[model samples]
Target chain A: MSILIDEKTRLLVQGITGGEGSFHTQRCIEYGTKVVAGMTPGKGGAQVFGVPVFNTVESAVRETGANASIIFVPPSGAADSIMEAADAGIPLVVCITEGIPVMDMISVHSFLKGKPVRLIGPNCPGLISPGKCKVGIMAGEIHKQGNVGVVSRSGTLTYETVAQLTGLGIGQSTCVGIGGDPLLGTNFVDVLKLFQEDEETKAIVLIGEIGGTMEQDAAQFIKDKVNKLVISFIAGASAPPGRRMGHAGAIISGNTGKAQDKIEALSAAGAIIAPNPAEIGKTVKKSLKY
Target chain B: MKIHEYQAKALLSQYGIPVPSGDVAGTPAEAKKIAAGLQGKVAVKAQVYAGGRGKAGGIKLAANADEAEKSASGIIGARLVTHQTSARGAPVSHVLVEKVVEVRRELYLSIVIDNARKMPVMIASEAGGMDIEEVTLTSPEKILKAYIDPSAGWQDFEGRKLAYGMNLSAQQVKPAVKLMANLYKLFHEKDCSLAEINPLVITGDDSIMALDAKLNFDDSALFRHEDIRRLHDPAQDDPFEARANEMGIKNYIKLSGNIGCMVNGAGLAMAVLDLINYCGGNAANFLDIGTVNNTSAVISAFKVFTADPDVKAILVNIFGGMARADTIARGIIEAYQQIDIKVPVVVRLAGTNVAEGKRLLAESGINYIEAADFLDAARKAVDASKGGRN
Candidate 1:
C-alpha cells in the first residue's frame, strides 16, 4: 500500500562494518526492515547483526537478491558506493551519508540520468514506510500505518511533524526525508508524484525550508498534477539573506528561495499552509475533513 | 571554503586564463616591493572574502611605490565592511598588488552549479561589472547561460556561442572561447561550487584578462583535493565560525541575536531561529550539533554558543530520530559539567527515548526549564532572554 517500499523490500547495507553503517543497520533490522546483505571492502566475511557482509555491492546483490540499498559509507567513498550500487542494478539506493561534495553529486546526478535507479539522499535521513519496511534511520516508534504521506528537507522537523500527526491519531503510509543538501537524488516534485499515485496516500505533508527553487517548482507540480489533500510548511522565515543556515541548501541568495516566496507560491497553488510545525497536525486534519 | 581574490586569480592563471601580474603581501613594505617590481602603476586591493570591496574603499589606485605602501597600510590594518559582509566586516590580512590595466570593456563571467537542472552552468553577460543577479532581474536578455553536461563534456562550440552571445569582437572571440573552456576545466577539476571572474575585461590592448576572481570550493569534495583545502584562510572567517570549523562542527554561524539555539538538523535549526523570532526574540547564533549527537560534540556546541556574549538565553530543541533525545540530554549534562553557563536555559525534547531524555535533564540539576511543545519552548526561551525567571 506504500509508495516506494513495503514488506517485499529487501535492503542491502553499504559500508556495513563501519560505525554508522553497523549501528543503524541493527536499528533498521529491529524495526523489521529486511536487511539481507551488507557490503564492506576488506570485511567480506564479517557478519553484522546476523546479516552477511560482502566485499562489493555487485556480489552482495547477486548473492542476496537485495533490491534496495541504504548507504552508510563515509563522505569520501559515498559517490563510488552509489555508482557501484547503480552498476550492480540496485533499483533503489538511499545514501544516508552527509557532507558529500556538491561536485561529486553533480557527477552522480549526471551518471544516474539514464539509469533505472532512484537515489533518495546523499545527506538525508532516508525513508520509512511505517510498519511495513524502513530503509533509513528514523525513530520507528513514532510511525503508524495509515494514509498520510510525508516528505521533508529536514530530519528533526520531519520527526516533529510525524509525531504531531501520530499524536492526533493520524498515521502515515510513508515518510521520506529528501535530505538538506543543495543537490538531492529525489526532490519534492519526485516524491509528490509518487504520493499522488499511491492509493494508500490520501493526504501528503511537505516540509520545505529556505533555499532552492524546488519548493516553488513543487508548488507548480501540485497545482498541475496532485489531486490529493496536501498540507505544507516552509521553515526559515527568520533566516537572514545570503547566510547559509546550517544546511548548504538552506541559503537565500538574491531574491530567490525566500520563505515568504515559497509560502506565497504554495498558498497561491491551493496547498494548505501550516503556520508552524506544531500546527501541521491540525491543518492536515482539517484538510482531510474538507 | 571561499578563497581570496589573489588565490582565485592564481587558480585561474594556472588554468591558462590570463590575469594581471600580482602578488600577495602581508605587510605594507612587502606590498610596496611587489608594486615596485611591477612594470606600471599598481592597484592595491584588500584581500577579504566579501564582495563590494571597491565601494568599501578596500581597492585603491597607487601612482607610485610610496602610494602603494600607503594604500596597503590603509587597507591591510583596517576592516573592510561592504553590503555583502556583516556590519563588523571582515578584517583585511593581506593586500594584492597588481599592475593596473588600461581601460577598455568590462564583462561578467561565472561558472556555478545550477540546482534545478543538476548541472554546472556557465553564465556570461555583456554587462559584467554590475551585480549579475540584478541584471538577471532587470535585463534578462543581457545574460546568457550554457548548461554543461559533465558526461557529454563541454564543447568548444558551446564556448564560442557564449563568447559570441556576450558580443565579444572577432579578435577577442578565440581567446574568450579558450578562457571559457579553461575556466570550465578548472571548475570541474577543482570541484568548485562557484568560480567567477567579474569584469572578465577586454583591455586597451585588446587582451582578455580576469580583473577580479572569486572561487568557492565544495567543502565535501575537499577530501580529494588536499591542495585546494590548503588555500583555506581562517583569517577571512569570523573567529567563532573559524573555531567551530576547526573543532569539526560544520554548521555554526554567529548571528546578532540574544537567544542561543542548538538544534539537530539544519532545517530545524533555522526553524528554531524563526520560531524564536516569532516569539519576539532574536537568535544569537545557528548551531546544528549534527547527526552524531555525542557528548563531546554537544560540549563543543555549548562552548560555541556560550562564547558569544550577546547570547542572553539558550534554547535546546532536539527532535530525535536517528539522533536520540537521551543522547542529546546526556551531552547537555556533560557540557554543563565542563563549562560555566550563566544564561537561562530552556529545552524541548521529543521523539525517541524522550521520556528518558527529559528525566535525565530533570536530574542534572542544571536548572533548565522544560516545555511541552515547540511553541511553548520558544516562548519560554524568548521570555528568558529578557531576564525573565524560568
Candidate 2:
C-alpha cells in the first residue's frame, strides 16, 4: 500500500473551472484518481470535465465527500484555498499553484500547524500512488506499481528519476513532489518519515536540490531512523553562490545551502549518493543489490 | 528584486523607520545639488546592487559639495567591483547623497524569510557593521533571532524582547522597539524576501537610525505590489536578463559559458548544468522554461540564448509533468523557425505525448539533434559545442 494515497482516495479539484484546473482534473480522472468534485468561487455550478462543481470547498466536501484536494487556483487565491480545504476537514491538500507570495504562505503555514490536514506543495507536481491513483500533474505513463518510494523538491527532476527507475524495472510504491518553494507544506523529512514507515516501500529515492537546510535535516532523520536502503541525488552542483537557479528555494545564500554541504551530509548519513541524474536508478539498483 | 540603497531608504522612511534624508543623482552636478541640500559631511554612495561597495571605493565620505561632485564623477560610469560582485563589476550610474551621522554603536538588523523555520525571522546582532553570516558562523550567541508568526503577527513585546537582546539602553528601547516592529511590518506588507539594515546605528544623541537599507522584494510576489515593483532598477541587472525579465521569462540567469541550456523545472535545469559540466562543457546560462510551454515564450527564450555570443550550442531538455512534451517540441520547432540560430540545438523530449512530440521534432526537418535521455542530451550538447560528434 502507498503512504498518502491509493484507489480509495476521493479527490477534489480547486479552481476547477480554470484552464490548468480543468485540464489536470481530466488527466487525474483518466488515471483513476476518483476526482469527485470541483470548486470555483463564482462559477461553481458549472461542470468541468464532467465533475460536479461547487462554490465553496466546504459545500463540495459536504456534497461529494472529497477527502483530498489539489489546488490549481492562481497564486493570490491558492493560500486561501488551502486553508479552506484544511478548515473543511479535508485530510490532505496539495497546492499545485506556483508564485504564491511567501508572506501568504507564512500565515498559511502557521495556520496549518497542529492541524490534522497534511499539505503538500504551493509550487509542486503533487503526488501519485502508481497504478492506484494520481494527483497534481505528474504523467501517469512513466510510473509502475512496486516497492521503491520517491520524494523530491522538484517536478521535472522527479519525472526524470522516475522514468529512469521505471526503465530499470524499479516500480515505486509512491512518488511525491514536495515542490521547489522555500516554505512548503511537507518537507523532505516529513515525506521521508512516511516512506520509512510504509511497509511496501522497500527502498527510497530522495531527490533534493541545493538550497535550504531541509536536505541536511532530512539526512539527520535518515541517520536516526530509516532502515531501508536510500539513494539520493542533490542537484545544483554546478550552480554559483548567491544566484537563484529558477526555483525560489534553489539558491546558495552565503555558505548555508551549498551542494557540497548537502552531499557530505547525506553521504555521512549512510545514504548512497547518485553522482548525477542519469546514475540515480543504477545507483539505487546497486545499493538495493538487485 | 533588489532595490537601490536610496530606494530602500525611501521606502523605509515611508514606514516610519528613521533614515537619513537621501536623494539619488544620476550625474555629478546632480550629486552636488543633492549633497548641497544636506548638512554636514555627506555620503556619496554608488547605486549598484552588489554589496561590499564601501571597500570597493563605491562609497565615499564627501567633506563638501565639490568633493561630493568629485566622488560622484569618480564613481558614476566606473565599474565598482566588490568581493560580492564579479571581477568585471557592475557599472555605477547613480549616487545616493545623504548626510552622515555620528554613530555611538552599530548593530545589525534584518528581516528575512527563514526557509528552515518556514516563517519570517528577525535577526539582530549587537555586533554590527559586519557580515551577519560571519557573525553567525563565529559567535552564534551574538545573533538574536525572533520568528514572527504571520497569523498571530509580531507583537510589540516580541520587538521589545529583540531590542533588549540587542542590548539597547532604556531610552533607546522605545524607538528601537518601534523601528523593529516597523521593519517587520514593512517586510510583511511589502512582500520582501529580505529587508536589511546592515548597521542599525545608535547616534551620539541617543537615537537609533537605519544607517543602511537593503530591501529585496520577492520577484514572484511583485505582481501584488505594483509600487514596489516600480522600484526595480533594471540597470542593476545584466542587460540580457533585464530583457528576459521584461518578456515574462523570469527564470533566466546568464552565466559565462558556451552551452545555453533550456530545461523544464528549476531542479532539472540545475541538474542539466551539472551534467554539462560533468560532460566537460560549460553552461552559458540557466533557463527554466517553467511548467507550461508556449510558442512565444519559447521564441523569446531562444532569442535570449542566441543573443549571447558565448553560446556555442543549445540544449532543450523537457521532461513534462504539468508541461506537455508536444507543446515543448512545437515551441522549439517554431522558435527555431523564427530565429536565426547559428548554434547547434539538441532537443530531448519526454513525458505526456512523447511519440507525438518526437514525431513533431522529426517532421520539422530542422536538423535538430535528438537525445535518447538526459545524459545523451547533455553529452550531445557538449560534443556539439566542441564542434565534434561523439
Candidate 3:
C-alpha cells in the first residue's frame, strides 16, 4: 500500500564489508527490513548480521532474489555499483553513498535508459517505508507508520521533520531522502508522482533546500497534478549568498534557486509553505485541519 | 572548484580550442613583459573567480607595456568587487595579460550540466557578451541549445548545429564546430561543471578564438583530475574557510551573522541557520562536522569558528541519529581543552547517551550552556547572541 517499498521488499546491501556498510546493514536489519543479501565483489560467501553476501549484484539477485538495493560503496565505485544493480534487474536502488562525481551520475543516468531500475540517490540518505521497511541511514525510531508521504533533499532535515511529524501523531506512509547533489537518479517530480498515486499517502510533506531547480520543477508539477494536501518546507533561508549559490544559475536558468523564490513558487502552486524548518509539522497540521 | 579566467583559457588552449594569446602575471613587471611579447595592444583582465569583470572595471585595455603595467598594478593588490562578489569584492593576486583580438562578431558558447534535463547541454547564442538570460527573454531564438546524451556522447552534428545556429559562414562553420567539440571534450575530460566562452569571437581574419574563458569543475570530481586541482588558488577562499579546507574539514562556509554554528550534516547545519533566523537571530558561519565526528575535526572547526571576529556565540547541534551524543560531548570537551574559546557555546544533544553527554559537559566546567531541544538551543543561541545571561 505504501510507495516504493513495503514488508515484502528484499534488500541487498552493496559494499557490505565496509565500515559504513556493515554498520548500517545491521541498523536496517534491526529496523525490520528484510536484508536478504550483501554484495562486496570479492567478499562473497560471507555473512554479516546473518545476511548472505554475494560477490556481484547479479549473483545476489539470482540467488537471494533481492529485489531492492542500497549502495554504500565509495564515490569512485558507487556509479558502477548502481549500474550493476540496474543491470541485475533490481527494480529499486537507493544509493546512500555521498560525493559521487557528477559526470559519473550523468553516465549512470544514460546507462539506465530503458532499464527497469529506479535509482533514488548517489549522495542521499536513501528512503524508508516506516514500520514495514527501512532502506537508509535515517534514525529508525523517529519514523512512524502513517498516511503522510515525506520526501526531502537533506538527511538530518528529513529526520528532524519526521521526528516532528511523529511527535504530532502524524505518521508517514514512506519517507525519502532524495539527496542534495546536482545530478541525481530520481528527482522530486519522480518521487512526487509515486506519492500522488499511493492510496496510503493521503497527504504529503516535501522538504527542499536552496540551490537547484528541482524544487521549482516540483512546485510546477504540484500545481499541475497533485490533488492531496501538501505542506512544503525549504531550508537554507538563512544561508549566505556564497558564490555558485545561484550566480551561475542566474546566467543559465534565470532563476537563482533562492529560498524566497522557491517559497513563492510553492505558495503560488497552492502548496502551503512552512515558514521555517521548526514549523514544518505544525504547518502540515494546520493545513490538513488535523 | 571555480578556476580563474586565465586558468580556464589555459585548459581551453590545451584542448586545441583557440583562446587569446595570454599568460597570467603575478606582478606589473610580469604583465608588462607578457604584453611586450604580444607587441600590439593587449587586454589586462583581473584574474578572479567571479564574473562580470568587463562591467566591474576588472578588465582594462592597455595600448602599451606601460599601460599594461599600470592596469595590472592597479588591479593586483585591490579587490575587484563585481555584482557577483560581496560588496568588499574578491582580491586580485594575478592579472591575465593577453593580445586583444579584433572581433568581426561575438557569440556565446558553453557546456553545463543541465539539472532539469539531467544531462550535459551545450548552450550557444549569437548575441554574445551580453546577458544570455536576457537574450533568452528578449529573443528566445537567439539562444541555441544542444543536449548531449552521456552514453552516445557529443556528436559532430550537435557541434555543427550550434555553429550554424550562431550563423557562421561555410569555412568558419568547420572550425567553430571543431571548437565546440574541443570545448565539450575539455568539459567532459576535466570534470568541469561549466566551460564557457563568453565572447567566442570570430576575429577580423575569420579565425575563431575564445576571448574570455570560465571553467568550473565539479568539486566532488576533483579527485579524478589532479591537474585541475593544481590550478586551485587557496588565496581565493576566505581566511577561515581556507584554513578549514587545509585541515580537510568539509563544508565550513562563513556567513555574515554573529552566531557561529557547528553542527553535524549539511542539512542540520542549514536547519540550524534557519532555526536561528526563525528565532530572530542570524548565524555567522555554516560548519558541518560531517558524520565521522572526528575529535580533531571538531577541534579544528572550533578553532576556525572562534577565530572569526564576527562570531559572538557558538551553537553546536548534534542529532546523533546513529551518531553518539557522548562522542560529540567528548569532541567539544577536547576542543575546549585545546583552544581558548572566548564566546558562549550552546550545545544541543539528541539520541543515545544524552544524560552521559550532559554530565560530561557539566562536569567538564567549560561553561557551555545546554538546551533541552533544537528550539530551546536556537532560542538560547539567539539570546546569547544578544549578550544575554545563560
Candidate 3 residue lDDT tens string, A1-290: 89999999999999999999999999999999999999998889999989999999999999989999999999999999999999999999999887788889888988898898899986788888999999999888888999999988888778888878888999999999887776778888998999999999999999888787778899899999999888998877777664432112211134466788888888899999887777788888888788
The residue pairs that clash in candidate 3, if any, are none
Candidate scoring better on TM-score of 1 and 3:
1
Q: What is the lDDT of candidate 2?
A: 0.90
Query: How do the residues B178-201 of candidate 2 rate in per-residue lDDT, one tens digit apiece?
Result: 998889889888889999998999
Q: What DockQ do the predictions score, one after another?
A: 0.76, 0.81, 0.57
Candidate 2's displacement at residue B242, Å, is 1.6
Candidate 1 off by > 4 Å: none
DockQ result, candidate 3:
0.57
Please report the candidate that would top TM-score against the real structure: 2
TM-score for the B chain of model 3: 0.96
TM-score of chain A of each: 0.99, 0.99, 0.95
For B248-271, candidate 3 gives per-residue lDDT tens digits of 776777778999888877777788
- CA deviation > 4 Å runs, candidate 3: A242-254
* Model 2 misplaced regions, further than 4 Å: none
Q: Which ten residues in a row have the lowest lDDT in candidate 2 chain A?
A: A41-50
